[model samples]
Target: MLLIILGLALWIGAHFLKRLAPDLRARMGNSGKAVLGVMIVLGVVLMIIGYRGAEYVELWPKVQALVGINNLLMVFAFYLYAASGMKTAITRKIRHPQLTAIKTWAVAHLLVNGDLASLVLFGGLLAWAVVQVILVNRADRNWVRPAPVPMSREVMAVVGALVVTGIVMGIHNWLGVQPWG
Candidate 1:
């Protein structure tokens, strides 16, 4: 639990730092892109290690799987993720699709995962996502609302997101720990 908390703190801290200190972040990106990249890599590596360390956590019991509902939520999360990327029309409406994706992803997981660590990780992310969107809305000069994109693009987004979501779901067990273990 400690390891998981620490790892998440580091990972989320780094991301939040950028938003809170845009000038500092910009300076680093401008003058030390390579170094910044390395730092990000190291941070991610530590987060993975820390999360793995706590994956064997018996601190909380596993919740029974609601396979059908869980899958449905994941599918919607993927749709939002993919919708943000496609330029067909939806992309023009929202300034940030990926953040929207994160919001959806976090919420979806919260419903499926009933553990302290899962709550911490997903809840923290969801909070951050809300903050980010609020900040962007406040900071941006103009907000454009575009028309709906073509149906084909939505379909493509769904397909693309499904593939990526499938891979992540598959590897999540090996990467973190078992669902019911």
Candidate 2:
């Protein structure tokens, strides 16, 4: 639990350093990017280790029905994540689609896996995403919506997202969680 908390803090802190401490971040310049990348990688490693080591205390009975909902939400999450990098209709409407996707993914996991580990992992990520989005919005007040891309590009992006989602679902069991059943 402590490692997980520390990892979450380091991950979120490294991400927000540029926005929260602009002068300090600017001082580091290019080296700061490398340091941030290392922090992110280390944070993820610690989080995985801590989460896997932590005991699972079920908070609610697992609902098989929520599996379907989780899958649907994950699909949308992947699509939104992909859309964030593209000038699609989705990006035009959603200023922070990647963060929204993270929140959606966290919520989806929470809905199905009501356990201590899941709660800590997903809830912490959800909180981080929310805070990060708020900080990003505050930093860039004048939000200029991107121009709409071609419909075909949007379709391709969705198709790509679907492919990625399918791959993830296929390997879900190997990851120790059977997302399907």
Candidate 3:
């Protein structure tokens, strides 16, 4: 739990460095980009260690029964994840689908897995989503839609989600976490 919390902290803290500490970002940007590089490495390492330290959570508490609706959220998560980084009209319409997807993922997990560690992990993600949305709103960045996503990209997105979902399921033993475990 400590490791998990530390990982989340490092991950979230590193993310906040830019939003909460723009001056620091400017300084780092000015200093030949060393600070940004260090921050990225440190954040990624901490998150992996923290995630690895978390216990295998199989039987989630029964606050809400796992159901098909929850699965819908996961599918939406897939869509958001898929749309990210694509230069298409879909992104312009969705405008931060990835962030929205994170929110959905956190919420869906929270509804299904009612454990302390799950709560901490997903809850932090939920909070991060809120902050991200707020930050985006505050920053007022506009998303311009380019050409529509090629039908192929849509196909690729579905395939990517399946792969990710499958990988997560396959590694449930190592992950100590599962959507349907």
Candidate 4:
């Protein structure tokens, strides 16, 4: 739990540093990017280790019925994430598709996982995404939406999302966690 909290702190701090202390971050220049990357990677490692090692403390029993919904949400989440990178039509509508995807992913996980560690991990991430979105919007008030792409690009984004979702499912299965329940 301590490790998880520490990891979350590092993750949030690294992410927010640029926004919170723009001058300090700018002063470091490219070196700051490297440091931030290292901090984020280390934070993720600590989170994985902490979460895996933490004793199970259930907040609520696993809801089997929600598994299907969670999976569905996950597909949408993946789609949103892919759309962000592909700059699909959806990206024109959504200013922060990636962050929205993260929030969706966090919510999907929370629906299926009802434990202390899961709460801290997913909930904290969800909060971060929401706050980050707010902060970004505040900073960049005159945001211009991306231009519309062709329908083929939209199709490609969907296909890419599905492929990524499949790969993620396979990885989950390999890790001894059944994502498709």
How close to the true structure is residue 15 of candidate 4, measured as C-alpha lDDT? 93
Q: TM-score of every model?
A: 0.75, 0.96, 0.77, 0.97
Which 10-residue window in model 2 sums to the lowest lDDT? 172-181
lDDT by residue for model 2 (1-181), tens: 8788888888988998988999999999999999999999989988888888888899998999999999999999999988888767988888899999999999999999888988998999999999998998898888999986889979987998899998998787778778786
Off by over 4 Å in 3: 30-60, 63-71, 87-89, 173-178
User: lDDT of all predictions, in order shown?
Assistant: 0.68, 0.89, 0.71, 0.92
Error of 3 at 69 (Å): 4.1
Q: After superposition, how far is residue 65 of candidate 2 from its true place, in Å?
A: 1.1
Give the Cα error of residue 66 in candidate 1, in Å: 3.8
lDDT of 1 by residue, 29-100 (tens): 655556556555666675556554555434444455554566666777777777876754556766777787
Q: What is the lDDT of residue 83 in candidate 2?
A: 88
Give lDDT tens digits, candidate 3, residues 142-179: 65556676778767777787777666656864666555
**How much is the lDDT of residue 131 in candidate 1?**
86
Over 1-181, each residue of candidate 4 has an lDDT whose tens digit, in order, gives 8888889889999999988899999999998999999999999998889998989999999989999999889999999998998899988888999999999999999999999999999899899999999988888898798988888888988888889989999999999999978
Candidate 1's C-alpha runs over 4 A off are 31-36, 55-65, 88-95, 146-148, 173-181
Candidate 4: lDDT of 125? Answer: 89
